[model samples]
Target chain A: MQFGIFSVSDITRDPVSGETPSEAERIDAIVQIAEKAEEVGLDVFAIGEHHNPPFFSSSPTTLLSHIAAKTKKLTVSTATTLITTNDPVRIAEEYAMLQHLAKGRMDLMLGRGNTAPVYPWFGADIRQSLPLALENYNLLHRLWREDVVDWEGKFRTPLQGFTSTPRPLDDLPPFVWHGSIRTPEIAEQAAYYGDGFFANNIFWPKEHYMRLIKFYRQRYAHYGHGTEKQAIVGLGGQAYIAKRSQDALNEFRPYFNEAPVYGHGPRMEDFMEQTPLSVGSPQEVIDKTLTFREHFGDYQRQMFLMDHAGLPLKTVLNQLDLLGEEVVPVLRKEIEARQDPETAKPPTHAKRLKDKYGDGPARQPKPNANRGDNVTGGSPYQDSE
Target chain B: MGQNFQLVVVSAGTSDPSSTRLLADRVAGRVTTLAGKKAQTVGTSVVELRELASEIANALVSNHIGPKLQKAIATLQRADAIVASTPVYKAGASGLFTSFFQILDNDLLIAKPVVLAATAGTARHALVVDDQMRGLFAYLRTVVVPTSLFASTEDWQDNGLNKRIDRAALELVALMTSGFEKSVRDESWGSYQHEYGSAGGTELSIDLDSDLMKLAAGGSAGQKSAG
Candidate 1:
């Protein structure tokens, strides 16, 4: 299983310190945090994209590229890139460019973006978001593979023989994960394309994810992707660990009690008891996380939400130490021992390229110096003709 | 679908022996007797909101439905009829009562027969049941009886309160006997709005042939004129 941490990139006031870090500091801190994630032996470091205030990651590829450049072994990805508002052409271009820059050490998750105003501001409709997501993803799926694409969709202007440049690193599309908490249609989309389905199982109970994950797996097999066991799955979790359980709870209480998403909503203990949140010692966290597999079955990836809700950089780094040092190792060993061999591993750049080309060289599309015409085969490129 | 029907009472009264519970029980009792007279059996179950106040609040704020709240939801989902009574506070239904209903899935109570009752200290808030609470049940799409039961201290001593209880009970029994909920649920359920996993997580039906489903499978959206 792949272990990682994902952040919503909210820059909030520290409840205990009574001070909010500036965007610059938070930006710098996220880079440091991503570096620490790699240092602490974690595999992936993903960040959310938000076009609103108190959120700094409006440009996920830029931030992720910087992090990818700074780290060697870690995979950088998006918690969710807006599939509704963002033009698929731009997503295809920008993320492919990021793929090339990062040496194929990246993937992306697509979401409809629940924030309502973001739709109209980006010339899209919230009412049309689900269909928009489906249509955009369809175009996006073609863009990465079909070099010369003639495409027309409702949300965007039609394209005639348009090729998204910076052809995917090793000519393989960065693996896509359809992230959804509730929508079964998104799960079906993920299954239909044999893409990964990531359940943001943070706020809601496990039963909600269990239902959707089952559907995704069933549909995955129905679509001839793989067996139900082979369908890729990912789950989101929250953890605050210390050497002692009480200290972990006490330290995390203020942050939990003041968080924008959950503060004043439910007591931290109740949330931990009912949801996937584990605020305790490493052993306690490990025990609680183990139940996830029992409920959702053996899945591919587990991403803990570690860096948001106004946690100081130092505390976050320290939390990573416990996670990387104490928590993840035990989880890895135990989960591996119990996992079904038929379950697919989470997608990575190297594995995907290998899957495409067994032992041979991967595709390297060489363009024909912007000939500005698709007359020479579908693609106006050296490789196509 | 059976001769024996389940009647679930959801009482948001806080006291040891609350008048809200008393009012709902009066309605339930009459419904049981009335059903018996019609050669049917009614089993009553109570969901004391006083016991689930924290759970409902937690669910509202945190979206985590507690075990007790889950059980209550399951009980209500199985209910053929419901007697939902609340104590009026500050000229409105109690927050516990409102929050509990607000947290329930919109489709859970669709077409279910219900009797609305309220016990307030003053008769000034008699409109709390008809004026405020009825709108809530309407939103849930529940078939609430036309008679709204309001029990003030004075009304408890008056025979008029018993008359209202009998009317609401008789209305609920008639709706249940007619099997209106069964027909709407069986025949026209899809016409009602529902989230994918709403209705206490039992609404698991997925239409793979839906227009959205086709779009999810790489079909065009705006080009084809979306539903």
Candidate 2:
């Protein structure tokens, strides 16, 4: 039952007053939102990476590293760590360094970014993004998990031998959740590795997200991970909460309607009806969110998109206070009642390390190794003839 | 502590097979074994700055040789104990290695121990171990081992050079397990502080390099803000 909020970081005109925050203000607002999330007992604070206008978070590591210094327990992460465009080697080393700085309270949701021009800007062809994502991630996985890799791949120059460093703190790499709104290939990739599948359940309906989550759950089992129900799942939601349902909707609709991302597209009311946006009271949000289990099952992480839609920082913090005080407690209790401990496990650093390295001390060599001095035999990295 | 450690083998040469990383591995491997620990080794093979004439136009303008080299900087920061092996280019260390250090947060290496080793064709540049590296380590405030191995390429494959590796390994294990005890701790009972109310030497920048470290060192000059 991990719960938190994410920001797409758009600076939009305050529709009523015609005021808008500068890019600096929006960035500061994001930091403030993350701190407030921790103050209210949230588990994670994920910031989306977009190398486009209106969005200020071009360098996620710099921001997340700053956030890492501010908070202690909250898992700082990227809402979308562009798996397609950015070099996986940089992603591996930067995130690994952040993981150390945060003391293992870091994870990332990988996505082939939402922007198109960013691909060429970073010297990547958008048409080859799928293959790029697959290949780069394959190298990234080895970089984090293995020490030395002699790799020759399509995306990058040949590495005779290379290792991405700071080696994760406590020898545990941060857990990864492959996030996708429409791509079933991303869902399959997540399931194939038994990693978490995060449906940006904000834009789409429950039926579409349900199918993806269900597919992931089935294929997760197909990969010999566990039962379909035991598959790790997370969902995204857009929410705005206040003391009363009408007041919350009234304050939020202007921001939603005027947002640069979805502003000109759909009416706020129609968007709410069609998607997971809950612009209402804290109690209504809790009730609506509790019903998510009916469609997506007992998921692990739940993130709200409250800071987006150009809402002021003060209003966002107020919404968080209401949700933290009224909403999360009820959801936590209700979810716990329905959860089976064996199946309803949250994906944690400990769980991930155990699943990958088995139930042994972090330092111990692989189970096959008998000699303590031999570094070559037990390694799954290099093949021994 | 789990006692499980990984080895980072940094080499500056572009030769066929890197002897610098190999020698670094030998030292790191033996020490890790002695500590009853498992190790994963990483090698960083560098492209010398002098050979970048084709890419110099881009490098001069941007000061970054693409993302691959950028990732190299990140890798160095993550290592627990680093073994820095470089070829003695000209009369000093390679210009590429020196330039790389300029990009790093120099203060981050405050108390981290590093085993320095160098390789060259001729033995004339041996003073780099003392003149350049030791001076750089002093500025960075890293604990430089008194024993540093320097070898000409002729004796690079010799067994006697490995004895220095064994000794460095043992000393590193001792240092790692026992931790560095500063001289200030040993002479804490000086007369002026006991007789009169002298404040003594107190500054925040004396300790480690992180923001929190600076705060801890800053004494009352530091302010902790609420999130």
Candidate 3:
């Protein structure tokens, strides 16, 4: 399994220190964290997008591109890109551009954003989130494959002879993983398209995601993509590591009691027992993560939420060191040994490009220079002339 | 076809010998006797929220039911009929009673026959059964019998309480004998939405031919209009 860390990019007061990092400081710290992940031999660095206050990652492509430019080996991705609010046309172009810049060291997980008010701000309706996500992703899927697209949908204005520019790097569209907490329709959508389904396995009980992942896998096989075992899956997790289990618990308790999303709710001990939030030594974290395969079956990717809840940058870095040096290496070996040969590996840029075109040149669409009205439809360019 | 009926009693009483549990047991006994008169066998189970207080509270915060709560929820789901009794506190139903239902899957009780009963300290809060509990079960879409039983301190000594209980039991048995639960579970279960991790709850399946799915697949307005 590919192991990495995903951050929601929240700026909160350190519950212990009572000092909150400025937005600039948090943004800069994320870059440093991503670089450290690579240095410690982690495989991926994904970030969440939020448009409201306390969350700074409104622009993921910019952040990911900067990280990609700085690192060569570590894959940069989004924990979730808002497929509901963002125009599919823009997603097609921006991600395609990022693919070229990062040399295909990127992929994205699509989700309907959690914040409701963001819908009205983006000129969309919250009630239509699932439909918007489906339609937008359908359009986005077509944009990357088809050179000229004639499309009409309920949410956006109709498109005729539209070509999303900066066609995907090497003409291979980035692999997409649909992330969902509760919606089964999203799972169906992912299975219908033969894409990956990622369950944010933190926060809720394992039974909740087990059903979703099982449904996705069964549907994936039903859709004739592959056998159930070959369907790609990803899971989210959270951990805090120290030399001793007590030290891990004692240090994380304060942060856990005051963190957003789960603070003031379940006690830290109960939450750990109930959910996938692991607070303990490196061995303890490993033992907990290994159980994921038993719970959801053999999966392709595993991402941990280590940097949120106002944990300091240094502490997060220290946690990452333990993860990379002590945890992931063992997990990689143990998981690979148990993985069935029939199971699919996580998708990457090179593999996708080769799958699309074996020993042949990839597509490079040469647009016919500006033909004012694409509707009139005469080879909008000089080449056709 | 006649089959054994599953009756689940949910009592939200805190005291050792709570009037709420007494009311629930009485209603359950009457229902079993009434159904037996109709030559139908009824199997009964009880979920005492007083015993599951901590588990319910933990479930409320953790969003996942413990083993005991899960068993209780499962028992309720398997029930052909339910007798739900709660004590009225301060002109409202007990918080524990409300919280238990809140944690339950809204669709779990859909179309299942329920006999709503509540016990209160005075006759003034007698309307709690209909006013509050009825509304709550209505939101759950349960087929609550019209004759709700309310037991006050004086109700125990009055003959009207037995009459009301018998009337409610008769309605519940009639609904149960009609096999409403079987029809819902077998024939039209797909029509209902189910919460994730709910007992016997399946994934939300979509009708591919529906307008919403068509629109999601990028079908145009004209095509929708044509259909």
Candidate 4:
């Protein structure tokens, strides 16, 4: 399993400290946190993309590329890159560019953004968001795999002979994960494409995602990708830990009471019991997280949301330390021992590269020099006709 | 058909034996007696919404369904008929009552029989049951009886309240015994608005032929919108 931490990039006020960090301060803190994650031996660091106030991450590629530059082994990715509002053409070009920059230390998860008003801001309709997401992702899929693409879709203008530049770092697109809270169509999309389906298992009850995941696995097999066991799956979780369970509860109580997503609604104990949220010692968190594989079957990735809800940077770093030191290693072993052998390996660029080409040279797209335009070319590169 | 017809009473009254529950109990009692006259037995269960107050609040806010709330939902799911009564507060039905209904799955009560009842301190909020609660049950696609029972402080000792309760109970018995909910489930369930895991978690089948599923399969969305 790939153990990682994902941040929603909320600039929240620390309830105890009574201070909200500035955007710049939060940005700096995220970088330090990512570096600390690598130092502590976590496998991945992902950030969420939000365009509205109190959220700092609008451009995920820029931030991820910087993190990728800073850390060697720790994979940098997005909790979700918006598929609804963002133009698929831009997503294709920019993420492929990030793939090349990071030397394939990056991948992305796609979500129809939760904010509704963001649709109108980008000249899209919220009512048609589902179809928009489906259509846009269809176009994005083609843009990544096909070099010379002739595409027309409902959401964007027609493209004749368009080539997304940088060509995806060794002729392989980054592995994609479709993250959804309650949309089965998104799961079907992921299954149809043989991509990963990530359930943001933080806010809602497990039953909510259980049905969707089961449907995804069935559809994946129906689509001839593999058996249900081989389909890639990931889950999102939240945790706050201390040596003693009481301290963990006492310290997180104030933040839990006022969280932006689900605070002021349910007691911390109730939320933890119903949802996948685990708050307590390392053993407690581990026990709760292990139940995920049993509920959804063997999965590839497990990501925790630890930095949001106005948590201080120092606290986030310390939590990462406990996670890296006391939690993830044990989880890695436990999951590996318990997982079915047919379970697909957690996705990475090198593994994908090896899968694409074995003991053979990967594609290097050196363009045929300076064709006047893409319109009159048989192929963009010398490798194809 | 296998056993006594299941009737559930959902009371959102604050007190243990508040007037709202009293009104619901009276209706349920009459329904039991009426069913017995037809040579059929009735099994009744109570779900006092006050007991699920925090669970309702939690479900409303965080989408977290507690253990007690899940058991209540299971009861309502298996109910052949329901008597839903609420206490009126500030010219509206109690928040506890409305909040509980708001969190239920849209298709959970489809075609089920229900008798709507309300209790208040005055006659001014009498319309709250018919005007407000009826709209909610209608939106859920339930078959609510015609006679809405509203018992204020003065109506308790009056003979007129008993007449309405009897009339409402008869309507409920007719709807329930007619096999309406079963026919809807067996024949026309697909016509209603539902999704996977709806209807108290019994609706788990996905329609793969849907327009959205076609879109998910790389089919363009234009044909769907255009049609």
User: What is candidate 1's lDDT per residue for A1-385, written digit by digit as tens?
Assistant: 9999999999999999999999999999999999999999999999999999989999999999999999999999999999999999999999999999999889999999988998899998899889899999999999998888988777788887788988899899999999998898899999999999999998776788999999999999999999999999999999999999999999999999999888877777777888899999999999999989999989988999999899999999999999999999999999999999998877988788778899999888887764455343464668776
TM-score of candidate 1's A chain against the true A chain: 0.98
- For model 2 chain A, the run of ten residues with the poorest summed lDDT: A376-385
Q: Give me candidate 3's interface root-mean-square deviation.
A: 4.0
CA shift at A323, candidate 4, in angstroms?
0.3
lDDT of 4 by residue, B172-219 (tens): 999999999999989999898886678888887777888989999989
> Per-residue alpha-carbon lDDT of model 3 for A1-385, expressed as tens digits?
6889999999989999999999999999999999999999998999998999899999999999999999999899998899989999999999999998999999999989868899999998898888888888888999987767888766788888787878788778898999987776788778888999999998766777888899889889988999999899999999999989999999999999888887766678877888898999999999999999998989999999999989999999999999999999999998988888898878887777777788798766566655565442635333343
lDDT of 2 at A209: 73
After superposing candidate 2, which stretches have Cα over 4 Å from the reference?
A: A353-360, A364-385, B1-227
Q: Candidates' DockQ values?
A: 0.65, 0.01, 0.33, 0.55
Q: What is the lDDT of residue B96 in candidate 2?
A: 57
Every model's TM-score on chain B: 0.96, 0.64, 0.87, 0.94
Q: Best-fitting candidate, measured by DockQ?
A: 1
Report the C-alpha lDDT of model 4 over A2-119, residue by residue, as the tens digit. 9999999999999999999999999999999999989999989999999998999999999999998998898988989999999999999999999999899889999888677899
Error in Å for residue A362 of model 4 = 0.5
lDDT for B1 in candidate 4 is 42
Residue-wise lDDT of candidate 3 within B1-227, one digit each (tens)? 44689999999999978899999999999988998888888999999999888778877875656667778887887889999999988899999999999988878888999999998889999788887888899998899998999999999999999999999999999999997877877898777766445443533554567655454434432321222
Best-to-worst DockQ order = 1, 4, 3, 2
The alpha-carbon lDDT assigned to residue A215 of candidate 3 equals 83
Each candidate structure's TM-score, on Cα atoms with residue i matched to residue i, is: 0.97, 0.59, 0.92, 0.97
Superior candidate under lDDT, 1 versus 3: 1
